[model samples]
Target: MIFMNMIFVDREKELQTLMQRLNSPTFELVIVYGRRRIGKTSLILRAISGRNDSVYYYATERNNLERFREVAQRKFPEVRYAREDWESLLHFLRDKVVIIDEFPYLIEEDKSILSTFQRIVDENRDSRTKLILLGSSISVMEDVLSYRSPLYGRRTASLKVGELKFRDLRHLGFSVEEAVKIYGFAGGVPMYLTRVTPPFLDWVNRELKRVDSFLRDEVDFLLRYEFREIGTYKEILRAISMGKNTLAEIRDYVKVGGEISSYIKKLERIELVTREVPVTESVRSKMGRYVIRDNFTNFWFRFVYPNLSLIEEGTYEITEGEYANYLGHVFERICREYVRDRYRVKKVGRQWWKDVEIDVMGLGNVKVAGECKWSEDVNPHSVLANLERKVERLGHTVDRYVVFARSFSTKEKMEKAELVDINDLNSWFMS
Candidate 1:
């Protein structure tokens, strides 16, 4: 019941594309899926805002198909024929727009629903119907609507929603520092952003106090709902959070004694984590490492989850004290992620050599390497020295060496190297 401003950012192009498809003559069937809280529903709602077309938006639950059909009937009253059966319901809807959220739940409740949908879509291929199925469970959505599934070739288009980019925060009225703090805590989830208030410290304090908060419970909920092997997933996340990057370290930490390839595959399927090999020509080498894909999950696993007992006991003071000690390092990491995201969006995909890893490296026609510092004062000499060492190790000259910091270096140092101040990060990212 909380009323907050709808801070919609980015996704403008996606919305326009969906609208264009909806207006086309062909019968459009789109599948939208993503991890929970990534704003699939929000994006769809925003696209349909102020539209006068016949639209029926139904959210599926764990109940039986009869109940779902009843709800669907309530939403779409134009069709005189109402039925509790799935095939009948699909057959009745024609020349209208239908959106079913959490589509996987409906498929799971009735296994034959996919085949029924395929038949209906085939029979009505000439009719003007725009149907969209949305789901938050990554695995279920992929398996059900993927090219290998029964409903494979039926979909006209598919979109996988993801987190808002750091560059989008400028539209939400957040300074670079504030955006970094929020992104580190919320991982660009729109729902999580609504829970955060101004005066960032206040939000942090409140978040640290709630034991049953979304931040505390999301990991378990996602694992239980999306993954079958919860124990293996937890072990892998714990290993990564504790700074175990290499596959060997993670396998040893899991203590499976043998290669944990199955567990790695499981984690990757759910998109909760990723395996990063050195950006090199050798793809078969076992030199890759695993890392958590989401920033908030990484922060939660590394800091908040480890101190659950303190959080539950209402020891806010103690938690805050400890957080203060490690906050600098956390912010430094966030800055690095921001710079890397900018590099990625700009089509810079280069990486440092295996022996020398820069905090952030942008590779395109021109190479850009960066060092992120979250200190009050940035020592330009130290950054330049590191860049020199990195260049020497790579045995190639980089096109640009940039330094990102809270505050710029002294006047003389600014003239020596490329410096991006914290305040200018938004512009830098947008560029």
Candidate 2:
């Protein structure tokens, strides 16, 4: 199972946009950002794979401008520099492809870097350079392009890199069950998926629970980069992961007297947290609930964050005990992805109201009511009975009914109800 390949799975759209800009005859100042390990660096590298005119420099807090200048001088020895400074370096690379990754590091080291970039973009308007400024700090990058920032109105293209789809996990050469286990933790992040192997539980114990591990500080690193106030965001995320999803529930959990709607709005904008309304309800429905949406982060907060002392004491059983419950939600997301494209399901989501909740509500040309069972040994008849009751309470008739489970003893066929087990999902999804 190769997970570190170059842009093979679900990045074709982003790669196309980048290649189109890179091959153009005009200047391009593109701003690209996403959370860490989302493959922003890999996409850019693959875009300039065979191009001999590209220079990729990763900036750091230690100040790498000198190293970047040295690299420019070494890469293009023909360009003469009158003074050894940023202006000369920009002039030297103005006609070539340049990528400065982790642009926020420079911004942190010096506030004037943004202004310097604005000057570079302005001075090289007619130059044929494709200069892309990339970073993992979503807020900082978006702020750079805001109307009040120095680099505002100078970017020709902007992109926020996103996670791969659940369907793309089939190509990783794993069995259907193993694929689900991988998705349960990695959540389609290429960097995280690269650490997957046989015996998924062992991998979890070794990588995720190890002291002084990268996974231990992963969430903290992200929070530090993204927000000035980390305590509030962490509390909010922990609250959401623990089923305190409603606005009132979250506020009560966090014990905040003021409003948390603005904090949640910022998180939603950065693709960390998502608010979901029932499919049958309007977009402005007040019955919406928030969800972390990222499987890795949710798993971290649910099992790891609360049990930090237990993890340090080397007592892994308590953390591992609740993992199955966590995978229940993961399996629901997988089933949602399965039916999202079927039955002409242009949009698929969960449906919930006061007294009833449907696991999967697929809306399109044909509406589908679905239920997902993560554990292999689930009673299909009882599950179907519950789903029918919810659909009844939903007060609307669906065009089709389907049930998803890990493995079922009977995939008994029926006109109104379809039972799709693990083998069925494997056959239908594996390419």
Best by TM-score: 2
Report the poorest 10 consecutive residues by lDDT, candidate 2.
316-325
Q: Give the TM-score comparing model 2 with the true structure, all chains together.
A: 0.94
Best by lDDT: 2
Q: Write the per-residue lDDT of candidate 1 for residues 100-126, one digit (tens) a residue.
A: 888877877778878888887887789
Model 2 lDDT on a 0 to 1 scale: 0.83
Collision count for each candidate, in order = 0, 0
TM-score of 1: 0.88
Question: How many pairs of residues in model 1 come into backbone collision?
Answer: 0
User: For each candidate, what is the lDDT?
Assistant: 0.70, 0.83
lDDT of 2 by residue, 282-302 (tens): 879988899998888887897
Error (Å) of candidate 1 at residue 78 is 5.7
